[model samples]
Target: MLTLYMEVSLTETQQCCGDVEMLFRRWSVLGLVIPTLLIGACSSTPEKEEISEQPAAELYLESKQRMNTGNYRSAIAHLEALLSRYPFGPHADQVQLDLIYGYYAVSDNAAARAAADRFIRLNPTHKDIDYALYMRGLMSEDEDSNFFQSMFNIDRSDRDPAMVRQAFGDFERLIREYPASKYAPDAARRMIALKNRLARYEVRVAEYYYQREAYVASIGRGKYVVQYMSDTPSVERALELMVESYDKLDMPEAKQDTLAVLKLNYPDNSMVN
Candidate 1:
């Protein structure tokens, strides 16, 4: 009986040892995998840190190269990243300016305008303030025009002139404040174009009133163009409309006065002839 008990005890000891060996093998596999995963995770962290710690000068150069290649979208990404990483770095101001142009290139006019405004507000005396003002004016110009209006040579004179007026005001302010700036000449030219557009818009309204036989309203619109948009090409048409409206209203003296002015200004005009 004692010998039989010892055999049973030895068998139980052998089974317990087998179970411990299997558990040790599983733990060994897990230990190898956990270290491998930890090493991989540790290795990846430095790589990300290296990428995020790219120097601002290098990033700016990369962005410039992208922009030179007309890859403005990629340039924008790099610029944005650089700005995010180094907000008060040496390239902060220039980065803001580049971002404005980048947004403009992508036709994100609202973003461009907002960037410009922020730059102006932050750096009111910046050397590139004139450039920002000019860009702001340009972004505001024709902002409401649709793709079809741009694709086809449709007349925008009859459309809403709110944006056009805002653009004109922007250009005017730029010229008024920084008359000697390099961009001032271009701004002045754009202002002239805007004035002509506004004059044309007023003339169209006058024509509409005339077509509806609203002679007094037509005369008022035409007179406004003559007074406020004197040098514009539409002034000639406005004067003619005024003369015609006055005649329709049976105001002989006013008709003769407007006719005389139109003839003096546009002698070869068909209406004057």
Candidate 2:
């Protein structure tokens, strides 16, 4: 009986020793992590600049003030300082957001998207995620500072299509994943506008094919509108164009098909009788 009791005590001692080793390992991991995070948080910049004891939040605001004054380069300097010194600061998100805006104001779209993307990734659930997403759309559209281009550049050059698609995806994800988000309703509204614009683009391409008398090609585009662009305002116009193309091609069967679809869709039919 004594021997059995001694064996149990030895087992208990072994278990205690294992626990102590595990605890030591955990604490060592924590120690390494804390310092690494601290070092990673540091931002690189000119070493001669003064870092006031005032809060980084205050410095971030000061940077924004520089942006408002049209000192975009100066604003970037301040924002970078905030990024490096206080990566984990309360105002980090706000500072990054300002940096994106400032970069855009300076006509640096690539840099703007990068900064905006960084903020969006870091603060996916921030209250201003909607704003960030919207900014991305506007940035992609080059709608911020190229206002002078409006006079002579109605030809948008497909410059923003891919970016617009990306922005649309981001907003859609935000709405789908965060239905309760304050940004959802507004995002849904903006999504409708984006859809209309994209649909119009589809119509233009279809019209190009139609103008070229490429009946088959035009039919492909028209069907795209009917199938994928039903919600688009240009849908009826697309259907009408399809019917016209079919008639021009002497494809009576296809013409009837197009007319039937148009009638079924737009029974009130002011554009077609």
Candidate 3:
């Protein structure tokens, strides 16, 4: 009788084990497999919403805000986006002008000049052409602008003259085309400074050649200043160098002519004595 009872208990334990295995199979599909399938399906879905274009006014305002807060790089992004979205929008002209200023504010001299040139070409009759021209000159000046350092008498004579010449041309255009422009006065002042810089650059080059005993080359540089840089202070020094250079070259006649001009222009010049 005890053996029979033990056999019955064993049978019941086997049944319980079978039920657990079935339960596990059902739980695996419901709890794991189905959820994974659902996740995969959800993840595979394509984006259904299109990105809308922001209005040009909105973009302009955003750019303006960025500029006002001194976020120049971000402002450039918005200004560029505005142009891309609405090339001929109501604010197109103003946006182009603002773009030039934006490029300038961040010291992007090349881009600023290019934008100014584009604006002038596209909007010749623009009432604000003066402002565009002014900005072009400003950008050019800023490209070569070391005047602040020049205040300490630091020589900038070794710098490239291309930018200075461009600035001079822009200022001259502004003065000739829009003499009444609000920016004309400032442009005029900057032109004077630029001319002096060019003259000084020529004088410095002539002096360099003179020092190196390259008398012919030195005379050429000095003559350039005397001919084109007429009223500048450097012309006097330039004349002196030319005379010295001529003497070195054994051209006494050339030396006498340069000295005569120096005396005529700068009667009290120390070089004349």
Candidate 4:
């Protein structure tokens, strides 16, 4: 009887040990899974909270506040978030316009120009369409004068005139399409300045060609300024260049006629004397 009882006790002890081992295994698996589950929960919660925290109107107002404080970088972040969240919201148009200005303030001229163009394209009849056009023109003008040039006050007259010409066209369109717009006066003023810049660029090209002894090319450039860019400050220099180029080409009649026009336009010009 004693031997049988001892054997049963040993079997019971073994069973208890097996149960504990199984429980430990279960806990081990749970230990790995719980941390992973917790990590996932923690990671996803913040993003959900962030998205839910600021709705469209709040984001728009926040962006405006940042803009008011001259915190354009922050304003841009808010504006972008607002746009992404509420593309068809009530403040979409104003948000786009603000984004353009924010990009411009930070000297992100490419982004600013793109925003302006997109706004103009999407909202052709928007009440503030003229504002977009004007901003686009300003952005195009800024493209020609980069940070380095602006900081050092470098002359951009000798640079490529493509952007300048684009800016001029933008301003011209604004003034023509919205003559009564509040922004029209400013756009007109910018157009005049851009015209002068284009004329100066043409004169610079004429000077370059003349210096290189490309008399025919110089004459063409000069004549273009005289005909297309009349009344600009560069016209005087263009006329002078044309007279010189005509003389270089041994076109005496052309030279005489150009000289006569130059004298009539600029009597006190050094070339006239």
lDDT of 2 by residue, 86-134 (tens): 9888777677777776666545668878887887888877876666665
For candidate 4, give the lDDT: 0.74
Off by over 4 Å in 1: 1-51, 142-153
Q: Compared to the true structure, candidate 3 yields what TM-score?
A: 0.72
lDDT, candidate 1, at 47? 24
Which number leads on TM-score? 4
Candidate 3 Cα misplacement greater than 4 A, ranges: 1-53, 147-152
**What would the per-residue lDDT of candidate 3 be over residues 1-273, giving only the tens digit for each residue?**
000001001122222222233233323433343335334433233343332478766777777766665555566778788887899887788778878876665556778789989999998999988888888887677667554455576676787789889889989999999999878888899889899999998888888999999999999999898888897889889889998999999998988998999899999988777
Largest lDDT belongs to which candidate? 1
TM-score of each: 0.75, 0.64, 0.72, 0.76
lDDT (Cα, 0-100) at 246 in candidate 1: 91
Clashes of 3: 0
Model 1 scores a C-alpha lDDT of 0.75
lDDT of each: 0.75, 0.65, 0.74, 0.74
Clashes of 4: 0
137-193 in candidate 1: lDDT tens per residue? 888873745445556767878988998887888889889989998889888988987
Comparing candidate 1 with candidate 4, which one achieves the higher lDDT?
1
Lowest summed lDDT across 10 adjacent residues in model 3 is found at 1-10
Model 1 lDDT, residue 189, Cα: 85
Q: Which ten residues in a row have the lowest lDDT in candidate 4?
A: 1-10
